[model samples]
Target: MDQFDWKQLLNPEFYILLELGGIKIGLYVVLFIVFAETGLLAGFFLPGDSLLFLCGIYSEALMKEFSTGSDFLNVTFLAASISVMGILGNMLGYWFGSKSGTYLYKREDSFFFKKKYLFQSKDFFEKYGGKAVVFARFLPIFRTFAPVIAGIVAMDKKKFMFYNILGSILWSYVMIFAGHYLHKLFLSQFNIDLTHYIEFIVIGIVLVTTIPVLMKLLKKKA
Candidate 1:
């Protein structure tokens, strides 16, 4: 393995993920990130979509760290585990938002907290109603704050949870499975290994996921 590169930390692939080494640690880090990105305000900057996609591509390695099961079992376990974390993370966000109330809106921007993102999430939630929880799961910054917005708006707990569970499962499974199966398909058909070109893959994923959010924000501003 190459010496740990501090510069790689800037890349979402290496951003507080696996830098410490060990597949087991990597799995735990992935769970933590899933939780933090949804649960904590400071987690808004974390890579949610791209990371989940990468998890799919590297599903085998991550799964082996936890279980020696068959391929189906491994992928199932990985997706299920991530889904649970995502649900829990959103729950925490909802809880925090409920407790904090309007204080979050009044809270000035800081390194970790961005007022604009919060407002953006509020607008998304208003537009989508309760469904924002589900739709926001696929979007980056919105996913981080949607749950909080749900709570802030005092959305019904049962409604919030229904969307939360649905969104988390769908998001986690889709991203992970997409990466894993695509990697398998390419390797089997063309003998191409995606892991070798992870940088390009990460950039592509980021752009695909984020560009829409940027355009939406810009359009709203205009």
Candidate 2:
């Protein structure tokens, strides 16, 4: 790749790890970010949706760059890897909730800590039950916290696992492959690179998915 291509690839909008040197650090960075976002309480602010989708689009670039006949970055590998990362992230989140999340309500709110987010997540989990695992996957913030709430409520492990696996597969495939195909289609049909505008597209997606929850919260606050 040329210097311009390298600059674009390293752009924070395209790849999450701007300081990590190159896309060769793909799977590790993707998995670690997903796991932290879904598992840790402090990770609620991470850009889960954008990262996954952008990673998918970048995976195509990586595949082309590293194409050694059949040794390219396989699409199935990318999808499955992301799905597994999501599943494990939720599992870890649930574990953390089961261990200490219930007592968190007692802790006084402080810097970087907001009880309202937890309460909102709890309300959603209670309203949706096991289905939240699947539904929250599409919604930002909720996707990371729903599993934590589930564990705090001591929900059935089997049920959580089932939906966790299902949701992970569905969300990962949809977001990742959507970016992949959108990039491909735009390049082929319109000769326009969707990648240039991917950050904006991701913002739109985040807003569309989370607006309902935001409105509900606003109404409740009123």
Winning model by TM-score: 1
lDDT of 1 by residue, 13-118 (tens): 6742463533346788889889988887656677788888888887776766567568877888899999999999999999999999589889888988899899
Q: Which stretches of candidate 2 lie over 4 Å from their true place?
A: 1-23, 62-73, 110-112
In model 1, which residue pairs have backbone atoms overlapping below 3 Å? none
Q: Candidate 1 deviates by what RMSD?
A: 2.1
TM-score of 1: 0.92
> Candidate 2, 99: how far from true, in Å?
1.6
Q: Worst 10-residue stretch by lDDT in candidate 2?
A: 10-19
Model 2, position 192: C-alpha lDDT score? 90
TM-scores for every predicted model: 0.92, 0.84
